[model samples]
Target chain A: IAGITQAPTSQILAAGRRMTLRCTQDMRHNAMYWYRQDLGLGLRLIHYSNTAGTTGKGEVPDGYSVSRANTDDFPLTLASAVPSQTSVYFCASSDSLRGDTEAFFGQGTRLTVV
Target chain B: SQQGEEDPQALSIQEGENATMNCSYKTSINNLQWYRQNSGRGLVHLILIRSNEREKHSGRLRVTLDTSKKSSSLLITASRAADTASYFCATDNFRGGGADGLTFGKGTHLIIQP
Candidate 1:
């Protein structure tokens, strides 16, 4: 099983454009997350889903949106891309919300907003 | 913006030596996790330690958590060239199901010398 798959391994977008990053996991994990990693900065959560049909905002949710339409899919969308939005995005999933639950991550999508 | 902070932004160690990285968080957490990331890739889960546990080990990797001090340490023994990567510590916020995302640290860049 492909644990987690992120589409368009890398992309280049112009400023003020709209872009969607796709993420899918075969594990059917209950929780899914979207995070962006910037140079010299930690991976900051952009949005998350506790389960299918439920979505929530994380620390840095501004300028981004997410939807958990089904157990296998959780996509992140950028409304108006800017240089600040240029970063590597990762999708992760976990079995449960309990303590010490291990998270599995995707390969990542490198987006360059010019 | 960032929940965890890692010490020694960069480290250089001989191939057979050990590498230790420390992380500190400001809030109470259910679990602390360590992840590894190559230069421009998704972070891979390494290990996790619960608040009630002081130490845990996996193969050549050892992790220690001190809830009283809200900190954790990750030790990798007998490092190899393949171990050259950035290490990050992530935390599960105490606020239950809503905090579905994991907050990560800036990360420690470990370089293994051949």
Candidate 2:
């Protein structure tokens, strides 16, 4: 509704193909995050942006990259998708640093790599 | 090792029963948050308890935090079939003044039978 909006909903990508999962929030949040959820592995942080013009690596940021060119959008990209990267990806944002504010999340994007 | 880990991995209960889930984290956190995910849906923030606070409640959900133990528990009273979902606890922290993001647990899959 008035919160976060994700694109595609789901995607099927071939291994070695490039892919980008889009995330945008109308809340004008300063912090945005990307996480991958896998069975038994929990949710692992891939990338995050504390504010516009600044981005950083998370717990697991090897194959994923993120950019926050503006306050409203933070898109996650995979240079070359891999099967291991095939999982449910979630995008979230908070008005302040995650440590101090509650995060609002996008519906999620289910990705499968073949 | 995961920054946050949930216990019991899965739980089952009948309608009108109470459901409890626990989470443990490794580092000092600014806050701990509980979220719910229905199947493949995006996460919905249920509650957030700050490091300085011990407990918080919203509607039928009650959350308790023990900073000394680095643990937290969520209790849902008089739960219903609509509560069937994966419940996760996330710890918000800064690593070396960087890597600002929430580390989530594997989560507990709660099933409320009708």
Candidate 3:
């Protein structure tokens, strides 16, 4: 009950439409991240926030944006959905950005762009 | 860019046997982690081994890290039907600054034949 939660377990969106995937964690973690998992490609980091009010791009940040208004939430937004963006998006968080820390992940949001 | 690459990509083992998956990374890392993802769910942290550490164990899971080789392996003993899932290795790059998120490798899909 006290972990990361992602909304709209699955969604189908048309290309060129705007969509935002919601992610919230109750762990009070300092680092929150968004990743897209595609077949054969694994999970690629899209964006990450180390703390409130600051965010950084990760390996694949194109066409996606994230905002960390506070420590509890990190939402990923796709400005214009593309068929290529159809994949499972995951939200994760860690106590800190330290390499030794383990991350907690939320049930992924399966987004399919038509 | 993907920093880690998991070998085999797919593995199959009989229940009660052991399953081993290997991962190799390109850059120096502060730590390595293993995670398991079920059919259509989020990833769960399995174990974490620091750069200075060689091997770590948690219950039936064993993780080995070799900084010199930039490789790590995950071994699950006494595998069960529930152990059938995709296992991934993630690395935390050793960049002086720690704002970056973990870099994940394409996972190894393991099937446990009961």
Among all windows of ten consecutive residues in candidate 3 chain B, which has the lowest summed lDDT? B92-101
Q: Each candidate: RMSD to true structure?
A: 1.2, 1.7, 1.2
Q: After superposition, how far is residue A33 of candidate 3 from its true place, in Å?
A: 0.1
Off by over 4 Å in 3: A97-99, B94-96
Among residues 3 or more apart in sequence or in different chains, the pairs in candidate 1 whose N, CA or C atoms overlap within 3 Å are none
lDDT of 3 by residue, B1-114 (tens): 888999889999899999999999999888899999999999999999998999999999989998888999999999999999999999987475545788999999999999
Cand 3, B chain, TM: 0.96
In angstroms, the error of model 3 at A22 is 0.4
Error of 3 at A16 (Å): 1.0
For residues A18-103, what per-residue lDDT tens digits would candidate 2 score against the true structure?
99999999988888899888888988889989889999888899999889999999999999999999998999988773346788
> Candidate 3's residue-wise lDDT over A1-114, tens digit each?
769999989999999999999999998888999999999999999999889999999989999999989999999999999999999999999986444789999999999999
lDDT per residue for candidate 1 within A27-107, as digits (tens), equals: 978899998888888888888898889998888899999998899999999999989999999999988745458789999
User: Could you tell me the TM-score of candidate 2?
Assistant: 0.95
Among these predictions, the greatest lDDT belongs to 3
| Candidate 1 Cα misplacement greater than 4 A, ranges | A97-99
Candidate with the larger DockQ of 1 and 2: 1
